[model samples]
Target: MYENYAQRLAVVYEATHKPEDFISADFEFKKMMRAGSCSAEDLRCYGILHHQMACYCIDKAVDLFDKVIGQGKAVDKDVFWRTKHQKMILYSQTGKAQKNIDEALAVINDGSEDAEDWICLIAAYSYSGDAAKAYEWILKAIPKFPDKAALYVYGGDTCRDLKKYDEAFKYWRKALELDDKMYDARYSMGFCYEELEEYGKAYDIWLDIARDLEEDGYEIEKQFPMELAEKCKAVLTDHPA
Candidate 1:
């Protein structure tokens, strides 16, 4: 009862973005927790909710997330590592004065067996300014979770951020092989081609994706990266692919 009502308030708050609604939802969730009415999923939802609140309460939020994790509710879910990831961000934002980034990194290194956990490990390393370790973990994760398209997408994104444009393509290509309909991998690949000044390839990739989205009832102009693609009209004529 408390869980459903609290979630309803959360949903309404999400749609309205009203402070009162947010506060009401938070109050109700706290009430549920105090009453011992929360299930593991409820704890997870409350943890996420607390994270969304302002930074003034972030320490409390992180504690709540830790409690959620302690309940063994993390398998096949991003909440496990994402909590650590968010905690790392908090540490970084405070110049590591409040909490050590190593604390967050340690959690990620240990007890991370799932694919999402591996993804979190990559993010944890990435956020701690260890790009080499992050990239290395990506290599490790891909081999273990060969069919997981999202790992390829994340690996491609990390490589792209490192300015290894060509290497990023290899990841995105593998992602596409795993899931041909992954628009994000395709979009990132288009940008990689553009960065390499392979205009024709960019145009071809974007044009195909734009058409695909249109067929799927999405308005291309309102769909980011789709709109960016249309701006490459001149490339169609100049590169003539």
Candidate 2:
């Protein structure tokens, strides 16, 4: 069945969110889909494949998610709730605060308690220019799921965006403590240092992140840390710091 191909694509997606990987997955998915074998599972994978930073991808993902939501009883209860949750996340990326909040509220009540729900709800508030609410919720969430490194990374993001650099630093440090391999939190810390004009500190963190990425088998040449490291090095070379 086409669901088999869709399952394979889902595995690849979980492994890496690289656009190239999605392109490769799309090839197989299309072959199966065009054969008149498309299933609800295939549709879900298709939606996930297009969920990225591109504007077109966001619109397409939302449409696909909406279609999947309309499937109602055809989908499992849990899968249906997760689908709604994902749609809420994509809506937050649309840059509409009220709409994002409404979608977020709907999904949380749709019955699937997950760490992702808390983080996405926090993100909805943060990206919607309501960092105060995001901050309030993060404080509440950490005590409940203290070891969720992803939550801390998102909390760091909210603090950084609010110009609370020190609080952001605390959040990132806690995140790294929980998951030493959390390069996202490390990058956030590096960005904060750069924002504070601490070129030397930023340079060191960037170099560390580059090494971490390489250790994780990522190509440093294609990674953002190396790019940041190069830029920070140039700043240090000129300023002697």
Candidate 3:
């Protein structure tokens, strides 16, 4: 029966990238678990499917996460960490910011303090409206992951959140220096320029971002660049260079 359902799941996977497709897969996995036929690998896949489903059905996602956690050491440690991380992110999105922050800190205390844990700490603090703590964690994270462009981008974001436009530009510029294709850093740099009234520079940066996103075939992600480009174009029209 599991083999038959697995074959059906392969067909569903090939046929759709839609979240609702996971509903059937989840049902099959639960049936296999009831029959005591599910493996650790199967539970890991179920957890990932739940994570995807969580984007649209968060309550069910949380329930599935709990089921994954109940598997204890049966679930791979990395998979367990990812499930907890997903829950933290979901909590933040659902306005349980403090809970997310507490859980993230607890995870750090439990000795999983890797680069991602630091990044999650920064995000949890930022979401909870504690910019100082967020900035501090970003600083700590930079030394740990010096080659990571995203960390510098997060640093720039923290600076921007605090209205430190010049500092934000410096951090974003550093991120771009590390990886020229860091689109979020480039976009934030343009935003910093706009805040500083450097309209021409902002326009140029945003135009380049739009071109880059289009060339990269990022259909959904291109909207951000396109909207920013239009805003910059409007500013340039108002104050021509």
Worst 10-residue lDDT window for candidate 3 reads 2-11
The residue-by-residue lDDT of candidate 1 on 81-110, one tens digit each, is: 556556667766656622443553565568
Clashing pairs in 1: none
How would you encode candidate 2's per-residue C-alpha lDDT over 1-241 as one tens digit per residue? Answer: 4248666865686577666777777887788788988778777777766664265467768888888879873667567756866776666666566787766667677954666667767877876788899888888778878889988998899999889888899989989999897878988888899999998999899888888778778884437888898998898899894
Candidate 3, residue 214: Cα displacement in angstroms equals 2.0
> What is the descending TM-score order?
2, 3, 1
TM-score of each: 0.56, 0.64, 0.63
List where candidate 1 sits over 4 angstroms from the true fold: 1-104, 127-130, 220-222, 235-241
Best by TM-score: 2
Output the lDDT of residue 24, model 3.
74
RMSD of 3: 12.4
> What pairs collide in candidate 2?
none
What are the runs in model 2 whose C-alpha is more than 4 Å off? 1-58, 64-90, 93-95, 107-113, 220-222
Give candidate 2's TM-score.
Answer: 0.64
